[model samples]
Target: MTDTLIQTLDVALGERSYDIVIGPGLLGSLSQHIETVSPTARIAIITDETVYELHGQAIEQALAGRQTHIIIRPAGEAQKSLANLEDILDSLFRAGFDRSDLLIAFGGGVIGDLAGFAASIYKRGMPFIQVPTTLLSQVDSSVGGKTAINNQFGKNLIGAFYQPQKVVTDTDLLKTLPARQLKAGYAEVLKYGLLGDPAFFDALEAGLGQDILDLDEAALTKAIHVSCATKAKIVAQDEREGGVRALLNLGHTFGHALELEAGYDGDLLHGEAVSVGMEMAFRFAVEQGLCPVADADRVSAHLAATDMPRISDMTHLLHDPAALLKHMGQDKKNESGHLTLILPRKIGETFIEKRADREAVLRFLTQLRDEA
Candidate 1:
């Protein structure tokens, strides 16, 4: 709660710009922040059951007397569905909420995406705030304004780019996160480094990575700030993802295919799949002679040293290269019926290959399966 500890970064979107406030115990002063954005507007909070069970009372206390409506749903990646979206819309409509009111996405990425997407379309765009609780949500999803829900075809195919009015990131909440979930989120933290900053990657390789996994307050804070700052900068330059913003999805194409194969059943988390996908990207790059084997080996080594999920960890789906390739073909990044992959040139650098050879990718997948 120390004023000196709190840091705020801005996502510069001209008039739609918003602040991402990071620190511990910021939730204690949530009401004041809410007042600044939507003082007279009614508040509707959408969160998952798990998060509500842990922090429900604190949230109620934070918003003490603000005409609040609490909507809780069962927690899981599976919950990010069209059915849940409809249910949320019905609840908002039944509650008589209007476009001028404020909607708060009060959980991890699932709730944030669902609620933010709901807010974006409801009554032609109601204002919303992001109060992301998970490490993945805090560093990545919450700041980007790329709200979405999953579908049968792929993950996050149905959604919108609707920025939140404010993002309240309380690092303290991560204390209650299960270790597995925390590690899953760390995959995203690692991603910021892998995709762009070599210095950040070097720091992670040194000891900052373990410090973050250990939940060291200083390390966690710094990583979150850097990740958000990186994402915010990209989003500003390419608000609609016409250019640089796609860099943010370095491993998502392959990762989403893995998620699709897993059926959004909570068995394979987005970040976990992303960890494997990043490794695949590097290996794929090496196979294509675009990057050095040393770079790919280093990426694999770092992921293994951190105890992250790897391609080997997903042997169950490895047998079907055709299926995985089919999923990849449907990736949102694909254009003109061609596969688009984000491949690494080296550590701390990546490029979007728009016309990824379908057969080459299949051969690579077959090789992974054979090796597994």
Candidate 2:
């Protein structure tokens, strides 16, 4: 691979800033990158069983001479819990890891969240690198420092704003993803365009969607680069999600509620939920007369082409509007006892509405339930 295939985007958070390197076949050079951050730090790789099986040998070969330990967990959203977090911490402690060692998150979003959370609490804080293997993690979760495990209360409720020392996103790894998984991640890529870049969305709708799903090298690299750049800019501006950062959660409020309702099972992937949530946000906006019906229709049409689940697809599993409303209320973005929702007025225009009315929200959700 030529150097041109690898693209690097920087997340500028002053002293906590790091580089997100996007490319295919970049894993072989991972050790060289980590050495730049911590030349002699021992390595603790946190990955799921499936990923480790597929890519563990490559990782082992990459760090041939280094002192490395591998900690594997079962792969699934349900695995992102306090129990798993505690087990990882205990295992790392037993492995003789300390503050100076590094934790390498080498899987999808779930592993990244779990390992990042563990790194944050272990020894009060430890340096870590994000080797995001999944497209979703590469574009969103891996770049940002927001790491957390899910609790009974909500998703990502028990987490911290901890940045990684470096992020290595090898696009080559994405080739192994199942079609469903790739589509789920594509939802996030589509989100970047929907939230802030209409041109990107236009391109996706115009045929870039197929290129991305097909894993065309140039198209895949470009998509991941732009997505990371968007995320990096947002994280730099609002490290703890106090302002414009809320825009990144455009579809999360509604989507997360649905995920919670589905019990985070294989029934609804995070990105799938977000895809449906984005549609719901636009649909709700149109219903309130806050967004033009044309724009909402366009958004739905583009996402529909990607084959992501629509609100109606999961409506059968969700019959109680009040229950979903309760989950939305638990969103970390809520402020002053009011639910803060990210609503889109157009393709590239979105705003945070902090005074979301609970009764009105319930009414809208009831209408959606009726459609089922």
Q: Model 1: how far is 224 from its true place, Å?
A: 0.5
Native-to-model Cα distance after best TM-score fit, residue 182 in candidate 2, in Å = 0.5
Off by over 4 Å in 2: none
**For model 1, how does the per-residue alpha-carbon lDDT over 99-129 read when each residue is reduced to its tens digit?**
9999999999889999999999999999999
lDDT of each: 0.91, 0.91
Over the stretch 1-372, how does candidate 2's per-residue lDDT look in tens digits? 558889888899999999888898889999899987887648999999889999999999999999999999999998899988999999999999989889999999999999999999999999999999888998888988999989888899999999999999899999899888898899999999999999999999999988999999899999999999999988888999889999999899999999999988778899999999999999999888889999999988887777777887986656989899999999999988998999998888899999987887888899988988
Deviation of model 1 at 255, angstroms: 0.9
- List TM-scores for all candidates, in order: 0.99, 0.98
Native-vs-model 1 lDDT? 0.91
User: After best superposition, candidate 1 residue 187: deviation in angstroms?
Assistant: 0.9
Clashing pairs in 2: none
